[model samples]
Target: MYGHDNKQFFGNNKLLLPEQPVHDDFLDTMEKVFHWSCIFGVFGSKRYISILWSALILASLVVIEYLAIWKVIRAVTGVARDTSGHRSITARLAGTIFYSISIMSLFVASKLWYYWRSNISLLWAKVERSVGVKVPADSTLKRRLYLVFGLMTFCSMFEHTVSMIASVGLDCPSSLLMKRYVLVSHGFLFMGQDYSEWFAMPLILISTLASLLWNFQDQLIVLISIGLTSRYYRLNGFVAKLCELEKHQTEFNKKSEALKVYTWRKIREAYVKQAMLVRRMDGALGGIVMLSCSCNFYFICLQMFLGITQGLSTDVMTGIYYVVSLAWLCTRVISVVLSASGVNTHSKTALKYLYTYETHCYNVEVGRLQDQLTKDYIALSGMGFFYLNKTILLQMAGAIITYELILIQFDGQGQIDTETTPSIHLNVTNI
Candidate 1:
């Protein structure tokens, strides 16, 4: 349904790429991810968009996704309780908190999407028709989307492999111990010692996908911001060209004032419309913005605390995974924060052209545009809790440093040791 012109992405009843390639804009690419596999986005077929289908799919999803999260959280919380080491227990709880945030992000984001889908689509169409100017394809936004997707996919796969390897033995799986380790990772076979691969494996897969919900939500915000930024840029350029043209007009072309005034009025309207679109987007995606910030903040601190306290494993694969995961996590955080911050940057940039553009005939449109960009303060936020900008990066670092100092002071008293006591039992699972 997301394909261009409503064409099938998979054609001829074969699960193969189309004969011709499909070029995806940022919105299309993001929607395609959720449409195909995302728990929240996968709805029933057109044949089943009725009440019965909605209820059935939503109910099944609740059982498979929400119930699974509760089960996993309960299982991990149990492990954390039984664990001997203070730091280890704290880390387990931190992972559970991070997981809970992911679940909530999806729940809220899905609700927002369903309720605001029409509003969002209308905003997109308005962008296309803004100021009677066409929105050119934004190649840069598409590239960023691809880069983000590549980094996230690699990060998730690498983390999953390392967590699996660390939980199981260093040796390849051949015996019952390795098999049991897999099930125990999800808390299905251990404690009670009742092993059922069937139930556990499916839930594990669903849990893994749920983990990607955070990524999906993050990328969606980034791409949408970039998308709006691109449109604002085009609007700015169009206005600038008019300003320059007016500045150089000859006496014979003085009648063009009427045309320029009309154009300026349109530009003013476009700028206002763009700003309104930001607010609409905020309402749709804002609920999860706080979750995005919180989860990133929590996970970065947890990974750093563990790396500093325990140091990386001497085992080469484990050590590499630790370092790479930490670095990749930071990259993801920086990418997301910067992407949204650009929206604020570009929104204010029109003021530069408005002030500097030497128009012979100044009009009320310019003043309105200037005031709209200046005092309006167009930026994404965590549902008005905090704005998304470059400052967040520093704020996060400072908070982490302060938290780490406290944790390290406690570690000196053996809160979390570099070497574990034989009494300690840790579950090496995806954080």
Candidate 2:
């Protein structure tokens, strides 16, 4: 059938417009409208609207991803048979692409939202400093970093929430039963062999809690620094005199120098405190990373063993889980390495400033450099670095968990016969 202006029509009278329209004006108008609408929509949206939308979209994506993964778990554990219909290769490819894109978008949006909020907070801190308020060392930058970390934590909770929801909504009683069986069996595998599985849950929980704490530690430090600095400003004695000396270095070089020594000494004290904070953070982060790795490994082993012993036919869902889990593991490893590197970098910067101030002495340029370096150190120490590290870690964690689940389903189905083993008579004779 055909419609007006040679537009093809379906049997039900639905018009089938040309993919590439013949009329230039129509295409132009459509493009114009699309661009204008997007512009208006973005602009008309309130402040933080992007962050809100991004969070919601990302949360939805996490939910869907988890659901998809759960389907794989079902197939792997033999809790449910694979009912994947006759999906075209193209359709499968498209679905995979969409899922990947959605996951990537979730990550990107989270990072962007964190950056936006952090920048805003940091800007405000800078403004406060400009108004003659003593901004604590790295207060502005730390705030920014914390904001990002806070967002990452929020997103993680959102993902966990989605998983819990899906567990309730999509999972069947049979699947839950199967999961419980696997858990119990795994517990036996550990305990029955004189290995205590008692430490598993506690270790996992502690690691998770520590990870959260490590992520937000910088924020707490910044807040404390801000408060202390504010108090020092109000005291109207040593700190005020120091600030005055800092401002009038040219007129009062000798007096400023004397004040500078005191300031340097105070800064050294602060640096020592900062170093201790860093040490605690490092230990906490390291513990979390190790615990996460061990937990993931255990999960993978347990799932694989159960699937194999049960003689289940792991399906597409299992494959997805395996892929996701492995990916997550890889991410964790990368994050740990990056975090270590960042800490080293921060330490080096701090040391460099300390050396410059103590040895070369504080000059005009040195003072400025010291201030800038301090800010950078503070920023680096904040959640910004931790957030980046954790983002990678979480993604990897998710991927590893997913992949292992898939592996259990798919790899567990095929069994090798041990009864058909070759005779060892020749080897014994040789011995």
Candidate 3:
């Protein structure tokens, strides 16, 4: 029932095909190949490896900082109960030294990684343009890649060392108190259980260490997914441009038909064929968007559920996490709405441009139409859509404010060591 003949009867000059096609398997394979290629291409690059390493180092630094803070809290709480105070002082000093080293290493590693990635990507883009081909799988690229990997490994080593030192300095009582607060507060609001009570300090310590190790990998996966989605959008844009060019050629040929019918007709047919190819390319890109959206939506839902279920209901900690999560969700929704609107606007403008091209042909003055089309494209692409960007910025600002409010409500109250009353005798004399 889905046929081109049916499409021809109506004003729908657009090609019609069944949603489920015989080439579905082939299309799926191609899409997978595209994703894997992009992943490997980026990962195989020296720059990306450096970045990955730097990210790991940063994660390590975060862990080290947490440990150092834990140690300091223990000392303040007298959890170690060292009567001499010598052990506490030594642990604090050691933790501070290691944390400082980790922080400095992380900073240097991040800068180096950024510089390397940017420079390498720039060089590769130029080389690809010059060669008129995709980047080569070359020995030089591999060598550079190895160098980046080695650098990243070295940076990670320092961070790991800091984490190890911090681990050794952890005090049982301070750890228990911190765990109780975090678990009773965050867990009750989000996780629904006090992990500190359910699990002993040693088990909690092990779990924390495991989480630190795994969280970086999870973050990397997220980053990679985002990068792939961006690439899909860019590729779709290019394909759309090609389609517009072909449509332009077809219109030029139709107009020339008045003078030279046969020659112009052939040229128009060629353009139409090219346009069809571009349409197919555009269709392929739709799959990418669908997949990316599904993944993002899943993440959004999971995070929202966790935040609401565990975080909001907690009595001990103020509802800062809940507020931040809510704001983030709102920000994400706004971004999605903006992106969808932009894409729809782009599609409409493209169709309009095509219609104008077909109807006006060579006799039509296209400069004004082209200008309008360009403006529409710019607006639809959301490249300069500051409003949506600002929405996210404001949401983050709100999150910070909410966090501060929570802190002030919970921890900012002044301590009263003693109570005072007015002298009764003085008051009686005044009366």
Best by lDDT: 1
**Which wins on TM-score, candidate 2 or candidate 3?**
2
**Top-down lDDT ranking:** 1, 2, 3
Model 1 residue runs over 4 Å out of place are: 1-27, 39-88, 134-147, 176-184, 187-189, 252-254, 359-361, 415-431
For model 1, what is the error of residue 4's alpha carbon versus the real structure, in angstroms, after optimal superposition? 39
TM-score of each: 0.78, 0.32, 0.28
Collision count of model 3: 4
* lDDT digits (tens) for residues 163-197 of candidate 3: 22222233436645545333321221112242445
Q: Which candidate number would show the highest TM-score if scored against the true structure?
A: 1
Consecutive 10-residue window with the lowest summed lDDT within model 2: 422-431
**For residues 1-431, could you state the per-residue lDDT of candidate 1 as single tens digits?**
12232122112422121122234365576555445434433332233444344344345445644433554465456743334332233433444554455557556756655654546765666455444432234557667766766676767666666656654547655665445444435442133344566655654555555556666667667667777778777777666655565565444244344544555666677777888888888777787687777777767766676666554444555555556667767877787789888888888877877887665567766777777778988888888988888898899889989998887888799765545321111212343
Quote model 2's TM-score: 0.32
Evaluated at residue 13, the lDDT of candidate 3 is 19
Q: Each model's RMSD to truth, in Å?
A: 9.7, 23.8, 19.1
Per-residue accuracy of model 2 over 1-431 as CA lDDT, tens digit each? 22232121122222111132222221233223222222212111234864454344445445534544554455446564322321222222222333333344334323322432445334333333332212223224334434534554564444333322322233447535324322222221122233333543432232233223222222222323333233223322323333333443333346435544544454444444444444434333332334334443443443343334331343333333334433433433454345444444443344343343333245554454355445543312222334323344466557766766665565446342211111100000000
